[model samples]
Target: MKAAITLESVTIRTELRPGDIGYVIYMHGDIYSKEYGYSLGFESYVAESFVEFYKQYDANLDRVWVCEHNEKIIGFLLLMHRGKAAQLRYFIMEKPYRGIGLGKKLMNLYMNELNSLGYESSYLLTVDELPAAASLYKRHGFRLTEEKPFSDFGKPLMEQKYELMLR
Candidate 1:
């Protein structure tokens, strides 16, 4: 982690460092399994995505924010360059950190950064099971654009795509 920005009691880091990528993978794996009953498949998918992101990471176009409290990572969000647009990925906050306005703060920071980067639009894919997160996305001007049933993580789920025109 690098470049910490303190917001209240939480510190948000804007740069990705050694072992931080692995921490993200592990955090998602552990938290999702505990919260949503997701299996190892989800972890594998996250790891693969991280590998791809690592291979093509451009600091000028791609940004990651890691939120830490008491020197421990508790939340994170990623903004990735996608052609002329952008993609929001790997957004998660630990249960204890939710409902305290951290999500909204992180999102506001993300949108401001996206705007500064000149992205015209942004999109993200997530499952319908996370209603709180979906609500947050909706509040941030993202609209549900697509949905489909899938059993990718050893369970039936409605995969949803949300998009926002960032003009």
Candidate 2:
């Protein structure tokens, strides 16, 4: 049985263990499929991007927050460096962990790291289906700079990009 998700019961880890990324990919595939009807293509996209991120990861320029409860992952967020910019990627929280200030905590960490690293700009790609997440992004000063029809994730939905200029 899962314990109640108070902050004290949760461990926010910044370093990845050997199996962490694989499990994160699996969770993304499983949860997105059940909640939003995403296909294996979405899983593949996540895996591919993660591989790219790993290849170029630098502790000085990148960061990841993995939230765990009782040693099991419950949420994840990643920041990847690109030239002089950064990309906020793979931000997700388990259903039971949403609406309880966890997402905001992760976003605060992301913003602080972005500012500390002095990235000129930052952006994230997300679907319009995620209204709560979109609202969080907006509240953190990201502007919806792009949107268009998209279907690669099994269901047709509008793909959106939010960006922030930090100069």
Candidate 3:
């Protein structure tokens, strides 16, 4: 099922404003998955403390873009670009906002932006534990580039990587 959805036009910025105070918490709460840590060759169940998350965000806020609806943040996209390669460091939607195709909308916008900015390709890594997310990536012309076992949450988990060559 789908509903007509509207997203607030976001202002992309390289500067972190005062409103970014709790950004670390919001970003990491969804990104840190014991399941994902294991799949990426990290310790099983690796969880970052508030301080650690904040430090990371402080160092990388310039690569992040936030999505706000009606004055509330509902999602964000963290990007990393190097030469011709772009990585989706983080992408997520809060529970109340999931499954209305916002993800696809956000990705399409990002892809167009990246293309205009001269990126030739994009890639992302996710765990098999998140089949729905993997499927979303697949639906968008991403092809699996790798699958392997990794330790997350102190247990072995399967990690999947996907890539898309852009125009």
lDDT of each: 0.90, 0.93, 0.61
* Model 2 lDDT on a 0 to 1 scale: 0.93
List ranges where model 2 is wrong by over 4 Å: 1-3
Ten-residue stretch with the least lDDT total in model 1: 1-10
Residues 33-143 of candidate 1 have per-residue lDDT tens digits of 998899999999999998988898999999999999898888999999898789999998887778778899989999999899999999999999999889999999999
Q: Kindly give the stretch of ten consecutive residues in candidate 2 with the minimal lDDT sum.
A: 2-11
Estimate, for each residue in 1-167, the C-alpha lDDT of model 3 and write its tens digit.
86445543433343345655366354444445432442322322222432333464433222556677656666766656645777775576665567666777777766666676677788888777777778877887889999999655446677788998986
Ordered from best to worst TM-score, the candidate numbers read: 2, 1, 3
- Encode model 2's per-residue lDDT on 1-167: one tens digit a residue: 95576866778999988998999999999999999889999999999999999999899899999999878999999999998989999998889888778899999999999999999999999999999999999999999999999999888999999999999
User: Could you tell me the TM-score of candidate 1?
Assistant: 0.94
TM-score of each: 0.94, 0.96, 0.67
Best by TM-score: 2
The better-scoring model by TM-score among 2 and 3 is 2
